[model samples]
Target: MRPPNTPPARAAATATADDTEFRTLLDRLSDKATEDYYNPFTTFDWPATIPTDELWMSPELLSFHGTELMDELSPARLQALSRWESVNFYSLNVHGIRELLIEVTRRVHTPGFELPSEFFHHFIGEENDHMWFFATFCLKYAGKIYPDKSVKLPGAPRDPDIENFLVFARILIFEQVVDHYNVRMAADRRLHPTVRHLNHLHHQDESRHIAFGCRLVHLLWNRLLERDPDDVALRELRDYLGRYLTTSIESFYNPAVYRDAGLPDGFALRRRLLTHPARQAAHAKVLHKTTGFLNRIGVFDARH
Candidate 1:
């Protein structure tokens, strides 16, 4: 058997004698991930049934959880909404992780990028598993996965350094944001057993991914600083990330989910709930940890 501390042969071979501390950190983290890895396929007891009448997501984590709008919902309506909201959350994971998978695979095996590339292999494998289970649950329960809208706001920086940094930064942001859901829902006993188990499984893998992402951002930022050092572009990237977070937060307030849940004037209801002061406060609270970490790492000067 391989020693507990030994990273796989591929990863071990990539770490040279003069590797930087950053590379060493990546190596250690990758080793730990391998040692602690779980097979996403068989990790959970895939329930033959999931009870929709019971809460799928915690009441507090729902988009309208603390708002007046939620108070208006009957117990039955609230339970129904929770089911769809859980679908939306999982659907978002499927699409968001797909994007990151593309970005990571594109760069994983490129020449002259061997150190972190070793870890990218594991990252790609884990993400594929995540997409599979998330999509599977959504399809089995909701009948379809949410489709992603292909849209990017204009004025994005064209610099390769800025572009590359944005990819990893955005991945970190998405993971951290969804992690807010995973951490809470996983521990809440009020949710269905299958739902709680899925959350627990995701949280287990993401803890490693989040650790790697934070360090990756710092490393990428150091590279961008040396090569570009353009404050204007940096700020633009930060603002872009802020926009990404806002849109991600708003996705939970989906009009379709509201409409299907039998709510009237779905669009109008979405607008009200999204603009409510309480919901606005909740958005900030949800993102606080991620934004705070990014700010500390010099990715942004302020919270998103």
Candidate 2:
């Protein structure tokens, strides 16, 4: 077995012919990130108070949407729910960005990652700015950012290539799910201007991030296949990623969000909503693009 710290042979060879297209894409993305940079601190005029009477998120994107739960709540209560849910959403971003940053920082400039290090610099900076603005919005307006409650599962031992693939794949899944919400909320005029602008700015940066992530994930997965041309490893990867996707979707339904909105039976409500057919359909809709991409790349079985 290779030493735990050693980078894979396939990964360390930086000038393989297969990498040519990826190199060109990386250059284009890095230049675009430089050209489109913005000061997140000054980009927004933070309002003294975001009105609580208005919706903070697009109603259709709400967890309770398309369910009987929607009709059960009065307008005032619904607005309260939207406010807290909005805070919860941004809180998730702060936590998710922190995790991805750590993972990316660890790999940047490490063996096998030399070519992408330049773009990694841009990615790391933008994501830090993202985490800052997200946390700022949460603390400035909501008084606190919700604590991350995601449970990390123990995994079987794996080689460096597998570990690296899992890290980037998880990041890609997280970004795609978030970009779904960002795209919708940014275009939603019904939301507060601060909320809309935050989403719009995030979506702009994430578009490039998502593009880079997709290419990198595909490259890594292909490298893994070349190193281990076996069905067992492929099956394991698919199963692990499938569970990660489910967990990602389930994080959106935080019981604390319901409790903060003054709803009773917060945990019970979360459970019921999660199992509801309408909510299931909504989950599938939100994850459609991400799942389709994975399927096309053969990371996921089409039958799933």
Candidate 3:
């Protein structure tokens, strides 16, 4: 990690860290890239095209607080929301995946990481295909993908090689974080077949990604420890990840989801659900998964 409040003369910001997070994240990236490299081409059993006539996604899955706002909607509005949620969720995935893919591309070829260097080529290929499938759905059905939100964070700008790992970690964390919805949608029979398949496929790939991330975090964290016992980098990483946790919880409150459902009160409801103790407990599930492994390896502090 970059020294906190370091003077500019010491080094340029985002210069590579010599720690193990850099090496570990890259290897995981390479592994995922390798696993997902032919993702759509090999994995998806597409036969011509799935019909889009019925409800694409379940409305309940899109609710801001797991409460029904759609029950209050006029039949026409209710139907529109069902259609919109399918598109909305898919669009969000496209946007989120695009950000993750770009991060993967930027840091994949950064110098000095030999193992990652080998796999970086495959990482880009996998993401490119993932993007293609997502974009294809949006174009074929909804006309275009929704634009990405403008989110900016100011922490250490990662060294290109190191950046790949941190960025990918964030991506993995984000996925597991929001997986409550994905899992719900994947199983909910009320959703259209196409919607179920989309979540099912993404969830399948995400399982591998999550596994890769868990192992990588240990390898990198251990490496960081060997480099420095009382390293400030670990603190920075914890703090950064905590912030990521907040964002993951907040993403579920789509004001758009509310307005379409005819409940302008959706934003307020979102605030409550997102901050609710029960909801927060739900968020803890993934943190538990990641932290348990980190603890078992003796690399993590039990305190959040």
Scored by lDDT, the top model is 2
- Quantify all predictions' global Cα lDDT against the true fold: 0.80, 0.88, 0.59
Model 3 regions lying over 4 Å from their true place: 1-55, 58-83, 157-165, 178-184, 229-231, 286-288, 291-300
| TM-score, predicted candidate 1 vs. hidden true structure | 0.89
lDDT of 3 by residue, 1-304 (tens): 4478864322221333343565566566666656554447656554355454455665555443243443456656666666656666667777777787777666554442334545545545654665677777777766766666535666843643234346656776766754545677789887666667767766766665666556555544444454453456556666676676566556655666556546567668777667666556656663666556555766446776
Residue-wise lDDT of candidate 2 within 191-236, one digit each (tens)? 9889999999999999999999999888888877777657877777
Q: What lDDT does candidate 1 reach at residue 206? A: 89
* Candidate that scores best on TM-score: 2
Clashes of each: 0, 0, 0
Report the error of model 2 at residue 77, Å.
Answer: 1.0
Q: Looking at model 1, report the run of 10 residues with the lowest lDDT sum.
A: 9-18
True-vs-predicted CA distance for residue 177, candidate 1, Å: 0.4
lDDT of 1 by residue, 1-304 (tens): 3356765433333433235876777778788878978887778677776876788888898878778788989999999889888898998899999999998888776642566788888889988999999999998878888777435656668876677778888898889989999999989989887888888878888888898888777766766775557677777887788788888788888777887788889789888888888888999988887888887877766534
Between prediction 2 and prediction 3, the one with superior TM-score is 2
> TM-scores for all candidates?
0.89, 0.95, 0.69
* lDDT comparing candidate 3 with the true structure: 0.59
